[model samples]
Target: MDNYGGHIGQGRARDSQARRDAVTVEIGYALCSALFLAVVVFGVVAGPALAFELSDTVQGTLVASGATLGAVLFTVRVVSVLNRFAREGDSTDGDQPSQPGRTNPDS
Candidate 1:
């Protein structure tokens, strides 16, 4: 009984960590998207000062691409984290019916 209680505690911690990770990923995604927009604006407004032979169009495109890629990756991370948390939570909750013939001690 003591061992079972310990396992349950560990499972709860894991689920909590997953939820935190999901929220962090969401915040990161939002920050990256905002940064991408800021970069585009900076490139347009400070093009003359930057003088890197990089056209505003090219800079804008690159920034937009980076932002989009970051957003997609972050979104995937957030989804995965949330899924993990839910899976762990479900396994921890004994209210749900267990699968047939499977020895999922946590479920």
Candidate 2:
């Protein structure tokens, strides 16, 4: 029984660590994306005004890069928000007791 309890505890610890790892990865990705976007935008907007004028090719490249980055960040944010709402809806629905006479629309 003691050994079984120890195994259960270890399992819980592993599960907790997995969750932490997932969160860390998510944060890292978000930070890297934001940093990249900031750098690209700054280079395009500030670099030219500061006397470090970029060539036409470089300017166009920067503009395209910034647009792509902005789109990707926007999509990620929207998806995460939608996922959060979905998760919240699921939990709330689960918490509610079902009425005997009523049927779930989802079911």
Candidate 3:
């Protein structure tokens, strides 16, 4: 029927759009990650040089701020990777008990 053909066409179009959107998201993520790395590298190489030109109090504050930022970023990345791994594991191992100590009631 014409309606069935139209529905199929719509589904294919949706699938194509979803793929394009996913690729765009991946590219954006890569760009942002590269930018973050560049910023961190620049901070590591230039932070001390810039701080030396400032007063002791200002230098200390800048160092503290940089350290805090680095720690927070590192923590965020670690948590994100862990969460992703957890989700992937769940998807690949359907219905299995996720926790090691938890036994399946039917077993």
Candidate 4:
């Protein structure tokens, strides 16, 4: 009887681990999607704008502004993806305790 109980407890703990893995996978997908969008937008919108604005701004300012915008957008995109992955992983890991080892002392 004790062995059976331990087996069941271990199974529950395994389930919790599987849930954590699933959350990590989901976060990876989300990060990929976000990066894809960033690439598309940067190519279609920012690329063209920067190209056209080349002649409008003073030569130095045009280069500076373009460089600044590019850096800012890239930073935002990278930080957002990293933050999402970290936050999701943390939340999922924190939310589940292995059912196997946990017990109420009062009980």
* Clash count, one per candidate: 0, 0, 0, 0
lDDT of 2 by residue, 10-97 (tens): 7557656875786666656656766666566656554554465778787776667666666676566555755664575456544234
Any runs in candidate 2 off by more than 4 Å, and if so which? 1-6, 52-107
lDDT of 3 by residue, 1-107 (tens): 23445644675576568757865665566456645864695488449857578787877777777767766665566556556645664475434566889975336
Sort by lDDT, best first: what order? 3, 1, 4, 2
Clashing pairs in 4: none
TM-score of 2: 0.43
Q: Candidate 1 clashing pairs?
A: none
Clashes of 1: 0
Q: Against the true structure, what is each candidate's TM-score?
A: 0.39, 0.43, 0.44, 0.45
lDDT of 1 by residue, 7-58 (tens): 4478667657976887687667656665565555555555544566687787
Model 3 pairs whose backbones collide: none
lDDT, each prediction: 0.61, 0.60, 0.62, 0.61
lDDT of 4 by residue, 1-107 (tens): 23445644675586689878876776677567656755665555446555675555565564555566655666676677767767856665543453757863224
The CA root-mean-square deviation of candidate 3, after full C-alpha superposition on the true structure, stands at 10.4
TM-score of 1: 0.39
Where does candidate 4 have its weakest 10-residue lDDT segment?
Answer: 1-10
Per-model C-alpha RMSD: 8.3, 10.0, 10.4, 7.0
- Candidates 2 and 3 compared by TM-score, better number: 3
